[model samples]
Target: MAHQVSASTLRRVLNIWPPFLFAGIRVRALSADYHHARVELRQHWYNRNFVGTHFGGSLFAMTDPFWMIMTMQALGSGYIVWDKAADIEFVKPGRGAVAAEFQLDDDVLALIRDATADGGKYLHWFATDVIDGEGDVVARIRKQVYVRRKPPRDGNG
Candidate 1:
């Protein structure tokens, strides 16, 4: 069985993680079940671009890892989850704090379970929009994750 990791622990760890800390990204909220998460990035001189707007890289950084994290936690030890690929589009210049929300629904979870039951890997795509303080979308990001069931272990023990 896999060890359970709490939402608060992960939030705290990620908050201080170098990439996020340096980019001014903060994990504001994570649901106890790991089905929902909210991340925010505050614009600062260090994270601003030549035009004084939120850097595109920082905007992408704020959204990275969320989809894979959610899927891994939900699927537990029986599966292997990895971030396969990603793409981000800047919809508008982010002037201030920008945030993104991630949600894993039951239907999706069930779909994942069904897709990977054959022990073959499955690639699933998830999308999220980074919105400004006024709720206007600042960027759109799509993440593709790979998941597969673990092969049966030997009974040597």
Candidate 2:
């Protein structure tokens, strides 16, 4: 994990990574604040299923880690963040390119900060929709993120 990348850097690097490059998944945009991001997955032969639609795994993969990453960046270095659970529902068959947008609002950030202020663990759920080129919903994704502020190390414990 020597590669310490910022949001903008990761946005560019992920676009050329093998899994994304091969599957036609692109990181369209990543805000400098790390509060927002956009990702898309094109329907290429390799990423298509036997029925000529998007593969379920690829759809899930495109969304995986985004919420966790965004939350981690928003929470900063003093907190530990991890993905607790996830669920995906395929609303419709993805026939073409699909995209998802991720966002972290200030209120939500405040909520997390307040809940974890006492070094307590909090499980927060975030949801995103995968939409097609025409803005039709293709899938819905929900991810639970676990966060806890690290304990002070003043030899008090």
Candidate 3:
């Protein structure tokens, strides 16, 4: 495609999606320049686990798209991004409203760019913590991203 997708447009598409919205996921804040965002998970039955705590799946879902999305936006065009791997440690049950923030700092971006500049794939790691309304940690998530430089579009083998 010859067009570009802005962060605001992507955010809007996600917000109105039934799965995200119905699951009580809300995007509280976003910044294009910084490539940072904040999302909140409100307490609701749809997100309740069988034991009445927050659903583990819902907790994982709330975090799935943030890092990859932010990294792609931060890195700009001519790069390939994908979620390589992820692991979550559930420290405590999420009982109420929970939130998580995603960030892409200059240092991190520099590292990614430098590593992938040679057209080699690079793995970038990021961490996020889901916090309750009282600011206590509910879960810690670790994500690994695969970044690679796109080859020139010459169509020559």
Candidate 4:
């Protein structure tokens, strides 16, 4: 069973999360509702590409788990969520810091809930744009998440 945690606690934990910390990605903001979040990746010597641009892998990693994590939290313990697939398009070379904002609207959440209400599985696609300091899109990330409602457990009574 997934343990419930406060957003603040999650934020703190994610800050120290190895994948993020090693990549120089920081979780800048996460809304209490889990509906909105922002992550930024700084361009350092270690994380930059040969051309001195933000590494493509780092750009993708910055936004990787947000959608699935948010969906699982919003749907509660009854549902299972996992990242099924993802694709990234490098639009432009990232010269400086790049950030991605994740937003999950109530309507989308409602749709997912209804779609998976009958122990059914649903595949949903979400997108995030990695933007540079100049506000231009550096890359676009597309993710496919799989969600399913678990079967009811039998009581020991």
**Residue-wise lDDT of candidate 4 within 1-157, one digit each (tens)?**
6666776788889999999999999999988888989999888899988888888889999989999988888778888899999999999999888889999999999999899888889999999999999999999999999999988988864
- Please rank every candidate by TM-score, starting with the best: 4, 1, 2, 3
Worst lDDT 10-window in candidate 1: 1-10
lDDT score, candidate 2: 0.89
> All candidates' TM-scores?
0.96, 0.93, 0.92, 0.96
Off by over 4 Å in 2: 1-4, 155-157
Query: Candidates ranked by lDDT, best first?
Result: 1, 4, 2, 3
Q: Candidate 2 has what TM-score? A: 0.93
lDDT of 2 by residue, 1-94 (tens): 1223598888988889888888899999998777999999989889999899999989988999888888888777888889999999999999
Clashes of each: 0, 0, 0, 0
lDDT of each: 0.92, 0.89, 0.85, 0.90
| Clash pairs for candidate 1 | none
Candidate 1 lDDT over 1-157, as tens digits, reads: 4456988999999999999999999999999888999999988899999999999999999999889988899888889899999999888899988999999998998999999999998999999999999999999999999999999898886
After superposition, the stretches of candidate 1 with alpha carbons farther than 4 Å from their true spots are 1-3
Off by over 4 Å in 4: none
- The CA-based lDDT of model 3 is what? 0.85
Clash pairs (backbone) in predicted model 3 = none
